[model samples]
Target: MRTSKHLIEQLASDLGYEYISDLHRPQLLPEIQILISSYDSQSYSLKEWKDAVQYITGSSCKLCECEEIKQYLLSLKNS
Candidate 1:
């Protein structure tokens, strides 16, 4: 499963005014696209999210591998 556009949009919006936003130029939009495409036909997991990031941004953040990454991140303030 893929992360929703709302999630990605919210992530981008949340980070819009941050310096870390500069860490990932172009922001989460492209990453969102990557997340959706990286979704597995089976089940989505934190591992999946990380895979998606790895697939796109080439990261090793396995915590992001889950479909729940969006919700999980959203739950944290200033994520």
Candidate 2:
């Protein structure tokens, strides 16, 4: 079984995020919220969000370099 750490790294690579574990998940919201916002900026769309969560949870490995994923990690650095 792949460890969570390895899974996160795979997720980052697949999504084009240079680093996913560096940013701390905000305590104010559930970790899933970060995943959701990381994938959708304008509206509530669960496509990318669900894919990422499924990757992290060891359910699937569907990876894509969507604009939303790029912006999400970039926003973390900018902030």
Candidate 3:
């Protein structure tokens, strides 16, 4: 099955993540907010956030995970 952005957005909503795809820099701060909300009520460190991006995007390098002009679909288990 093909997972389009809209499908991802619906999945994100169902998964408790705030979908915000229109970003040029992929701000860590806002992304952190989604991370915090998507997961359980907990504090998210920069390292954990980086790891989350890696896990979600399936990228080896952290840089590859953080795409500047692309909006990605992410899910956090027990978050």
Name model 3 segments beyond 4 Å from true: 1-42, 60-79
| CA lDDT scores, all candidates in order | 0.43, 0.42, 0.38
**Which candidate achieves the best lDDT against the true structure?**
1
Ranking of all candidate structures by their lDDT, best first: 1, 2, 3
lDDT tens digits, residue span 1-79, model 1: 4544333343444445343343254345454444444434235445544543444354455452354554433333222
Error of 2 at 16 (Å): 10
| Residue-wise C-alpha lDDT for candidate 2, range 3-61, written one tens digit per residue | 33443454455445687653233431244334534433333233544354444343443
- Candidate 3 TM-score, C-alpha based: 0.27
Per-prediction TM-score = 0.30, 0.24, 0.27
Candidate 1, residue 25: CA error in Å?
12
**What's model 2's lDDT at 2?**
20
Which is superior by lDDT, 2 or 3? 2
Q: Report how far residue 67 has shifted in candidate 1, in Å.
A: 6.3
